[model samples]
Target chain A: MNKLPDALPVEKAAISDLARQTLHGTVDEATNARGRERMISAARAGASKSNGTQRRRRITRASVLLFAAAALAVSLVIWWPRAPLTFVTTGGEVTSTHDGGVRVATRDAESVTRFSDGSVVTFGVQSAGRLEGVRTNGARVVLTSGELHLDITHRKDTAWSIEAGPYVVRVTGTAFDVAWSPSEGAFVVAMRQGSVVVEGPLTPAGVSLRAGQHLVVARDGVMRMGEGTPPTLAELAVASSDAVALVSSAAPVVVSRAPSAPAEAPPSSSVPAIATSVAPSDRPASFAKLVAEGRYAQVVTAARGRGLEWVAESASLEELVALADAARYEKDGTLARAALEAERKRFATTQAGRNATFLLGRLAEDSDGNTARAIVLYDEYLQTGGPFSAEALGRKMLAVRKTRGDAGAEPIARAYLEKYPKGVYAAAARSIVGTP
Target chain B: MPLTVAARKVVPVVRWQTPAELVQALLAAEPEAHGVLWDRYSTSLRAVLRRSLGPDTEVEDALQEVFIRFFRALPTLREPAALGSFLFGIAVHVARGLLRKRRIRRWFRLTDDGEIPEPPDDVDPVSEQAQAAVRRLYVILDDLDDESRLVFVLRHIEGLEITELAACLKMSPATVKRRLARVTPLVFARARNDADLASFMAAPDQGERS
Candidate 1:
């Protein structure tokens, strides 16, 4: 092979010598040592692999034996019988039964039972309940009358149940209020936080309830599930407290009333200030108040209670933006996008409308992973010179880099650096341009 | 030919004067032969890798791969004296594979289209300007197909003759000359158009050492 000497062709010499000079780096002694060590390690690995067949066979046999031993040990630990959890009651009288059960009866005051697993069950005044059985994992309680508030600590092995008349509420880890009237045959469950599954005679398959939900079953098999925060107890006591109803006061769909059982009805007057349903005349202030209070989940639920898409379309501009912000905080990307699009449509050429375009771009890029659409929307918003111009420009440059590579994004990056030299994306822009 | 060495570490102070001697020692599994082999050819191999895969790319990994392939294919080598050529062929093959993978990765925007490394603090200002021009030249080369890019790199940056490129690339001499002829003007045109490289292109002597 001929070594092309200095008599090389002019075209070859132009870039050739320049590239050679630029890449003229030498491997130092430390680098050579590292390379030698890597090769030696690789050589040792290859040599060991020559006898890998027998070694692998031995490993396989040992692994099987070890796995079998481990499985047996795990089985022994799992199937072993454990002692049941015990508890003591306070502020009430408990009558112990022969079958390791206790009956909690409160005459003039409430009763609070503390369990070993960090669970608390508060029985209301004049209430009667029974702990039928207690086990290592959980216990079963039957509320004969009045109300009971439960705050069950979350554990992986938890299993608790509360039976109110024919309805059985199963709980793993949650807090809720349950009331039952034997004579009235009415049951009500209002979830404060977490979730529970209720199985009943009306519908045997059971209905699941999440936080911020109220369920009531009348004697005539009429079921009503409403969207509102349940009534809060001032002291978890029946004395000095009014009847707190769980039904929504705004649009309470009362199909049938079972003879006005005051003890079983969660009063509307005691509803927490945040969960209070404002009258229809006060809804505009209610929307703003709900957003200011950071009740995003309640806002989403209330918006959906009314036709959400309709509210997005015909609601006032402020209401629409509030709904969009609420849905975004709630992580309901679809609803957030809908409200943003509606804001842009109804209030086009306004500052909020232009700002909606930038938010929609964020949703498109982050939530929907549509880089091309995000770039288009960002470009539209950038053309408007809106409040989010800097942020939108930075996002657009990154989105372009994601889809079109550094070469495609360099012009935008350069523009961004020129305008905002000390901006947030300055470091990233310098990286793309290979500048300091 | 069942060649086997006894299970013992052989760390001999053997100086391999020729490729034939190194290959013989390596085949015999002399542990010291690997280091000696690396000492003899590592510098040129590094240069070749740096030039072919750009300076910012993983040249160390490619260099290790070249030696590993050489070790793996040593048994099949028919002529011991042609070790250098055999290794060069393997380096070209590895470089071609990386170039193809790099193209696919670039299409997916998975990798940056390589940047010019920072010049040393002691580098002259003129050399720094040339480095920027080199960066632009690499960006243009990134647009070429893998085979064409390899042909250009081997012929020009590596200073290989047409016949040597043909041998290294497993192409005919006419094909090498044809690719070189086709790629030269295209590269020069791109360099002339590039603002950073125009100065280097206008005076070509601007890149020369004093």
Candidate 2:
């Protein structure tokens, strides 16, 4: 490996010179004049109150007042809200509550809590895990740890739900209760009112529960269905608070349960507490069956009906695509492409749609030589200014370069490189330039 | 008792002599503020700006603009300690914007023969010389696309950390890292060519200052 240099070369020096020149414009005398005029106007406004020789004194007083007011305003903006209170759990989950009722969700082991005013609190996890939600309600939080709980309640015309996770809980105007027990390696969903659908790779088939119904999906794909009792105060407390607080409160509850253990029999066999729901469309089993039986169109129909179209998480979409791909393995390309395209159209106005559009563009470019059309699509994606814009721009530049050759490509590449040198496609641009 | 009293009296003088206070005084439009600030930073600012902007442009005009913008924006500045970064940010923006416009103008002037006019011989060569030194230090920076070059300059030359550079350049740190990664090897290879550059590139060994 060769070493790097300590100084720049003449060409770079010239480029840097040009860079500097391009950056600094002559201070517009007019802009300066405007600034001066504003200042003078402000000063005049200050001086108009007092007459005669006292005008200078009044202007000085007014300036002081203005300075004081400005300082106060700045301080108010800076320190208006107290710093966010951060709660983090062992399994790479974090929650934050602000003075305002805004919540943030971050996963992939680290999460940040930003207040409505943009004050931030960052927390890290020692291990990989998921952070479900970081909810805020006037600085108080009910974080559910190592478990997922969904509580649905009906109030007048609205159905509300509160999803409790290890360090955060999200409340929406819907009803559902979900609990994940790491010990049992099972997830239980019990809807109190309205309807709740739980979707995940680990969710069991035929396990969609209605109000007063409960379903358990085990990690091993076991499906259990039974009548559910409304969550006890103790269970609610455990589900609503942090791990430390829950343990302390759960100790007494465990002690109390020990006395009743003798009288409790293994509940009746008729209820089938762990039996799979018999509904054809209810469970992960059903979805798996749909794929196994080559019912992709049915799966898509079911997914759309369940409002899964609105879900932005790529994992979910990937799961659906995988099912479709598996069911149509002999024609995987056609099915996957169709599924992805349909999903893209379904989500066109959504964040997910934007992502899908980028994916579609990549698929188009790589899978086919429709470079011209792909470039245009990529440009549209970039213009949307979504997270994928930089990537799209890079792809667009490459596509254009490949089709247009050096003379045609250089300007676009140069323009992109100039604007977004650190963009996702920078290496590609370099490759283009480096090519003989 | 006398010594204690004297020490107590000296505390106020020490307390009052802070950069923030001086800045505040300057904002108060005290004549002393200009002199004090100028004495403290004007020479360094001039050197950096002139070197960064090159000699062809009017350094005095740029310097005056920097100060004027600084003063106007001073009241809104939250952290006075970050004044260096703030000034640098302004300089980077001003310089980059100017350079971009110049490029556009020059691009339009390129004839059908693919010929572009050479810069005048009288062009101030100081910035050119500095840029040459920079290029010599990191040869890859010369060949890098404009965006990559700016990121490199902001990160390596300006010595901004990843996050700060990202914010300055309005880019993600991941993007910045990618750019840096792409340029790093080339820069290293170029730097290795020069002994002085090589010394700078060498990893600092623990307890081995020499």
Q: By TM-score, who's the top model here?
A: 1
Q: Which regions of candidate 2 fall more than 4 Å away from where they truly are?
A: A1-436, B1-17, B50-58, B110-146, B186-210
Quantify how close model 1 is to the true structure by its C-alpha RMSD in Å: 24.4
On DockQ, the leading prediction is 1
Model 1 misplaced regions, further than 4 Å: A1-11, A50-436, B1-14, B112-126, B206-210
Which pairs clash in model 1?
Answer: A243-A267, A244-A266, A244-A267, A245-A266, A245-A267, A245-A268
Residue-wise C-alpha lDDT for candidate 1, range A66-104, written one tens digit per residue: 999999999989888878877888877899876797888
Predicted structure 1: clash tally? 6
Scored against the true structure, residue A210 in model 2 reaches a CA lDDT of 59
User: Native-contact fraction for each model?
Assistant: 0.38, 0.00
Which ten residues in a row are the worst by lDDT in model 2 chain A?
Answer: A252-261
Q: What is the lDDT of residue A179 in candidate 1?
A: 84
Candidate 2, A1-436: lDDT as tens digits: 1122333332333333333433332334555344334433433333233243367777889999999999999999866774433343332333333333333333555444443422223332221122223332223222222333332222332312232221112222334445544333334455566565433322211124456665443333333344635333234334422232232322211100011111122223422221233353344556554443334445444444444333223324444443333323333344445555665665566544555566557657766667887887787777674545555777777788788886666776777776455444666776676642
DockQ list for all candidates: 0.20, 0.01
